[model samples]
Target: MRALVLLACLSVSCLAQRPQPCTSPALMTGDLYVSTQSEKLTAFAKYMYDALGKRIRLREVGSYNNKTFELDVLLLYRQGVVYKINHKNSTCCKKRLCTKFHPLEIPENASLLGQSVLGSSSGPGQGLLVNNWYGDLQMKKGTAKYLSQVTEFGCVPVSVLYHTDQSGWVVTSFYNNVIGLTDPQMLYPPPFCQDARLEDEDGEDPETFFSLF
Candidate 1:
């Protein structure tokens, strides 16, 4: 009886350590910061995301090649359209969205690295508990490996790192101030994009941009 009990306890411990799938809130609004290790590009954006409705919108300010620019990106999966608007010049480029909407969720096949506290654990509510997960994602041209950290309780994304053959060594995104979506209209394209010019077939690929989310 003692040996049987020990074995049962071990089984439970193993099961408890297994990685569990987690999904973000269906509708969320947050601030996103993106950086690339191989490029001198960095962006900060306020974003609205609707995982269930397949819509996303971002108002971003980014610096690249010593140039600063403000841009807006709107992705509507149902309409299969992506609008990239330059806020500085009031130019908009409408492009066909090639990729499907991928929700911000820990993939089922992701391996949990472990869990850690982001701050002091000495007092209650002093720190945030986060889970780390790693996985390889199959992309159109190559496989991209990713590491993600999210809040343990609500599965809110804290940060994500991706390495892809085309995208160089590393691209990381940090999420902050995530909350449930407040305004539904935030997901819609701006009025200035109504007369946006359609991008050429061989123009900037939307697939590479959408994969970040």
Candidate 2:
């Protein structure tokens, strides 16, 4: 009976230390930087607190179709509610979207990228674990230059930079093929907010965008 009791206690302790699912944008707030190794993509966010509520302003830039693609996103979290305003500009189009949703909809792996940061300490619940599943990968001869564009392309190195308690800031990089797939809500906002958008000349041909993918 004593051994059984000890086992139960140990199980409870492990459960308590498990990294909890990220149900709050607050976990992702503050100053954060995310980027790809090739420097083709980069994002920065600054969260500030004031009398009204906590607001996170974000800016991201990348290259598409040999042109620059940029996004400005503003997230407001108040009273357990999340509100978002995002503007995107690229060679294909310019879009502005707004939406409101519950934080519970966000997956734990969405913003818990700190886990893959290189040289970061890990304990019972420091970072969440994610799996990358791939199947049916095909390649053609003389297509070596286009491998990076393949949806199931080779793995790439990604890094997440964050502020630490003792240290000023730290960076960690890891291999990822499906980086943001876990965050569907974040990748594409609600459809209602997608109306009245502006399309660039190249937007007419979506294939031009997918060809690179």
Candidate 3:
């Protein structure tokens, strides 16, 4: 009787656990802070989630030592903002538990600060508007422009919201070159938009996709 009970206990211990999705859309978000090792991108995906395993999921997209690439980072996110803190080989996200998060501190000014204000425009806009670049690629051409900016003393353009008043971010992508911003709010995230492995413009999914970025 003891042996039979022990065998059953072992079987239960080996069972796999399933991940669940958010039960509601209550504006979910994450904070991130990252570190890198010799070009090795580990904390690449800095989005946080519930300890219960439902907030974020990672799928290997592709790689790059040099060159522009794309990926499939399908995240059904519902939250405030994803702060890509720091730069270069690292990007730290901010969730409730992140240690580096700090509130903005700015002096209040009422006198003339040499600023121009204009009424908001209502119309369709152009350019990319995604946040949290995921997927995979070993770019021989571009670097983690955003992280690299803070890493190597360069500036990276990060999209605040997908041109909307709020929707948070759509995707984080990379472009071969930099884009200009008229409204800080309309700026594009460092690189341009990227497609996922399965969502590549060519629509080709590698037989075996592995991520080392």
Best by lDDT: 1
Off by over 4 Å in 2: 24-56, 69-98, 102-117, 120-213
Candidate 2 lDDT over residue span 2-99, tens digit each: 99999999999998754443222222322434443344334343332121234333434544334565544434434322223443332222332232
All candidates: TM-score: 0.83, 0.32, 0.18
List model 3 lDDT by residue over 1-213, tens digit each.
999999998877765221111122212232222223222222223222221322232222333333323322322223322222223433333332112211111112211112111223243343332212222212222322221111011212222111111211122322232222123321222232222112113332221111111
Which is better, 2 or 3, measured by TM-score?
2
> Which pairs clash (backbone N, Cα, C closer than 3 Å) in model 1?
none
Worst 10 residues of 2 by lDDT: 143-152
lDDT of model 3 at position 13: 72
Model 1 C-alpha RMSD vs. true structure (Å) is 3.1
Segments in model 1 whose C-alpha atoms lie over 4 Å from true places: 1-19, 86-91, 195-197, 201-213
The number of clashing residue pairs in each candidate reads: 0, 2, 41
Candidate 3 TM-score versus the reference: 0.18
